[model samples]
Target: MTYGHAHAEHYDLVFRSRGKDWPAESARIAALVRDRAPAAATLLDVGCGTGAHLVTFAKTFAAVAGVEPAEAMREIAADRIGAGQVHPGDMRAFDLGRTFDAVTCLGFAIAYMPDTAALDAAVARMAAHLSPGGVLVVEPWWGPEEFIDGYVGGHLVREDGLVISRVTHSVRRDGATHMRIHFVVADADGIRTFHEDETNTLFTDAQYRAAFERAGLAVTRVHDRDAHPGYLVGVKG
Candidate 1:
């Protein structure tokens, strides 16, 4: 709940530093939603950092809205999808007084919630915002069994004389993976180090199903793609 400006900006710099291969990933996620959603008119993009998914959803859906908590992240998302479309609120408590045909929390955003109680609370919030026969797609965090500790690496991207590098390390703890990212951006302004810490709960597929059920959403089935091992498509019933 404490991630703020610097953390959010560093997050954007870390994942999107490459600015390549994301289109394919975004396209794939959009296609999956189109296939599984009851209708793709209204979508609630929870934790829609920088509007990556919101932009994609807007291209297909008639109405698209995003809920982003971080101010820095919201600014980026607003620039992509327009300021009016993005709501500034926490994923656990944001309410729009309406329902959507589809709700998606991609990029393991749901895992940021500290515990099962927090996860359940957030899911209940999402469930309330979803219309009858709507669909909810969640890309959960990698389970503890899948985490690889002590992984240290960095990637650099160069575009138009601007360079960005993101270095990351991971530590696995009680059913969670805590990651620290170091971002270095080189431009005419020089180089700087921006640090951020993120924690994701490693909830199992069975636990995910149970949480959805407890939230009053019927878990139709889970579609797993080997390319994205931690992704799950749950059609609400």
Candidate 2:
């Protein structure tokens, strides 16, 4: 979520090059919500980066809205889903003055929380935005046991008369993953590079469950074969 302007501008392009299927992922989320709340008509996506999922959610539900903190990313999302649909707000404390039938925090946005305290606040806030019998789905970052230290990855894509390359190296430090990402983009304007140092907390499964339970939600964990890490589904009764 703390992405730079350059990073935000090309986020979708880079992810698409890395084979992220937004449509399919959005479909699965919609299915999960409908399964729990058959009459689900509204949805609110927290940390909705660039409105990729919101675009699909708008088609699936009668009403869909999103909350994003990053200005650069939020601007792009607003353009895609209309300015009124995407709001500027933080995940831990955002009030839209209304409730929805389904609330989702996807794309491992929870990992951005610095600690369990923030995680608890964020979950509680999302749950508070849900109506009776509403469902809350949260995709989590890799658990402590799943993170591999000193991991390296790279991707290169050539399209639209531009050549883009991205590389990343990650290490576990102080119960979190510190990722050093570098991007090189070349076009008629010449080549330019951008660097990002991002940290994602490695919260345990128990911590996730405890947060959901503390929010007064009946919670369950699920693994989507196509998505890494997995998701925690909670129902507000």
Cα error, residue 123 of model 2, in Å, equals 0.3
lDDT tens digits, residue span 171-215, model 1: 888778888887777889888777778788888777777778888
Worst 10 residues of 1 by lDDT: 221-230
* Cα displacement (Å) at residue 11, model 2: 0.5
lDDT at 30, model 2 = 90
TM-score of each: 0.88, 0.98
Clashes of 2: 0
| Residue-pair clashes per candidate | 0, 0
Cα lDDT of model 2 by residue, 1-237, tens digit: 477789998899999989998999999989988999999999999999999999999999999999999899999999999999999999999999999999999888889999999999999999999999999999999989999999999999899898989999999999999999999999999999989998999999999999999999999988878987767999999
What lDDT, from 0 to 1, does candidate 1 have? 0.77
TM-score of the candidate numbered 1?
A: 0.88
Q: Rate the local accuracy (lDDT) of all candidates.
A: 0.77, 0.94
